[model samples]
Target: MSAMEGDSFTLRTGLPEIQRDDEIEWRFGSSRTRLTRIAVGNITTCNDETFRDRLQLERQTGDLTVTNITNEHTGVYQLSIIIRNKKSTKRFAVTVYAPVPIPVIFSDTSQCALSAERSSRIFLCSVVNVSHVTLSWYKGNSLLSSISVSDLSISLSLPLEVEYQEKNTYSCVVNNPVSTQTRHLDIDQLCQIDCDLCFDSPEAVIRLVVSALISVAAVAAVVLLVNDIRRFGRTQTMKR
Candidate 1:
């Protein structure tokens, strides 16, 4: 079944026809006093469809599509088939739940290390409008773990660590009584490498400073070469 932005879901059923003189009714609510909604298939028989009646057992038949279904629409739907005055019923239950939202990623930092250097990413998937909760962690599309934290206000933390910091995606899913939420955490090890590769050695500050100056000079020379080529192209274009 697929759901849309609105609180709607469509059910595709395999059963097409019910025996003659039989009726189908959708029932819901665990408690009898809870007030449930019933949308019967409005059964009618014979070729002309003349046996249809709102009440009384006049033999019902037909296919129906129920729309605008709400939470109260959830419950047991039974098909009562009557043949030769003998009746048999079959029932199915439905539960309505909202779609899970995208989670928010919160972390103080986004770096980690493998051999000589290290980085760490912290994340928590916060969700609302839920009662009992279950949390799951994922690496890319694969499931890592699933845990239950019944209280809604409780928080779930996921820590990601790796060797030789690189780009990795971490996902967390939060499922509750009312809805579900998911969030992703991304850590770039290449950036951490940039941090390490761009820094100076404490023991040799003078040499580090000289090395830094040389690197800047090299970058500037490359930029100047590119600019000179662009200027030469423009000059040739003007002459042409």
Candidate 2:
């Protein structure tokens, strides 16, 4: 069984009911420390400091629930049941994983436009403050690259290079044992190479727009002036 940290997880007993004369015990962790036990109509939970006030053992069905679970609570859990003096054992493997963060896709060339030397535009897929997760890049449902980390997987950013005219779908995904998050690529938005960047500054862009607008205004003024001159000439000819 797998669960996310801070969420409650339950281990089902799979029994319809527990008889009044049965003995049940649940132990957890690497040391197999005794956590809770029920015997002949009596229930008791041991103070295993790590799981204090978090272990709930159902009296009717012998189900065990761990509340507000954390990464520390991930391990093997053992359930022991004794009925009619016959002992039966069942074991459960529980893993608590951190919440997977949404992967981010951004153009690596944002700081500078692509140069003539660069054959392909670069984009990066990244995640932050995450652990125990695999980060992968997919091109049209096909896996291109993947990287995983043992503890902190935030360093597992993946990079991809493609042509400026790339039209194929791409996505980045970050996943753990229990959760996943994905981000899709927008080629037009992230992989674009604006020729206007050749001007090199925001002021240059403003100047270009202003110059085009002035040219349009000058053309319109010239057309109006020519019309007025023709109208005046027509009035003089009619008076003659």
Candidate 3:
């Protein structure tokens, strides 16, 4: 079983109620060092640096629980019970993982326009410093793409391609056993214009418009000057 850091977990023995005469003991780690013991209506807990003030045992049953679990507390645990001089042991394997981080979605076209081609816009979803998690892209309720990793301390990324005028809905989701996070992609915000030279920001659009007007005015002035020169030359030739 797996659990996130700082979370609580329980190790169930599935045994019946404890008897006063029965003896119970719990051991932890690879070396199987003693963690806690119960015998003759008395409970004795290990004061090891790893489990101090974090271990609990049910007095009625032999079930064990640990709170505020950390990576150091991850290991194999053993429970030994002696009933009528017969010893029975059970072992549990536990794994600890860091909490999943909130995923961030990025796009190369955040301030660009989209073309008719399907690959004109590319979106990337990423999460960093997470382990034992899955990152996925969803279009509405449909799953688009997903990547899963086990116990790896690295970032994960998933890419999605969006086409012009073909938007349904899109989102990125990152999740682990303990937590889940989601981010939605707004197509309108990403592709403000859908032309060859689309402007991302309103200020950029304004500048483009102003530049175009200036160019038109310059062209008009040049045309008028050429016309005036041609007319003057004709008059001079006639006069001569």
Estimated TM-score for each candidate = 0.48, 0.76, 0.77
Alpha-carbon lDDT of model 1: 0.48
Q: Which candidate, 1 or 3, has the higher lDDT?
A: 3
Give me the runs in candidate 2 sitting further than 4 Å from their true place.
110-114, 117-119, 152-154, 192-240
Q: How many residue pairs clash in each candidate?
A: 16, 0, 0
* Poorly placed runs, candidate 1 (over 4 Å): 1-20, 23-26, 30-64, 109-119, 131-134, 149-164, 174-182, 188-240
Worst 10 residues of 3 by lDDT: 110-119
lDDT of 1 by residue, 18-82 (tens): 55344344322353221112224343322212112212222223323334454445565444444
Q: Score each candidate by Cα lDDT.
A: 0.48, 0.84, 0.83
lDDT of 3: 0.83
Residue-level lDDT of model 3, residues 185-239, one tens digit each, is 8876765533325654456578789989999999999999999999999999999
The TM-score obtained by model 3 is 0.77
Which residue runs of candidate 3 sit more than 4 Å off their true CA positions?
A: 109-119, 193-207, 211-240
Which scores higher on TM-score, 2 or 3? 3
Model 2 Cα lDDT, one tens digit per residue, 47-100: 888899999989998999999999889899999999999999999998899888
State how far residue 14 of model 3 sits from its true place (Å). 2.2
TM-score of model 1 (CA atoms): 0.48
Ranking by lDDT: 2, 3, 1
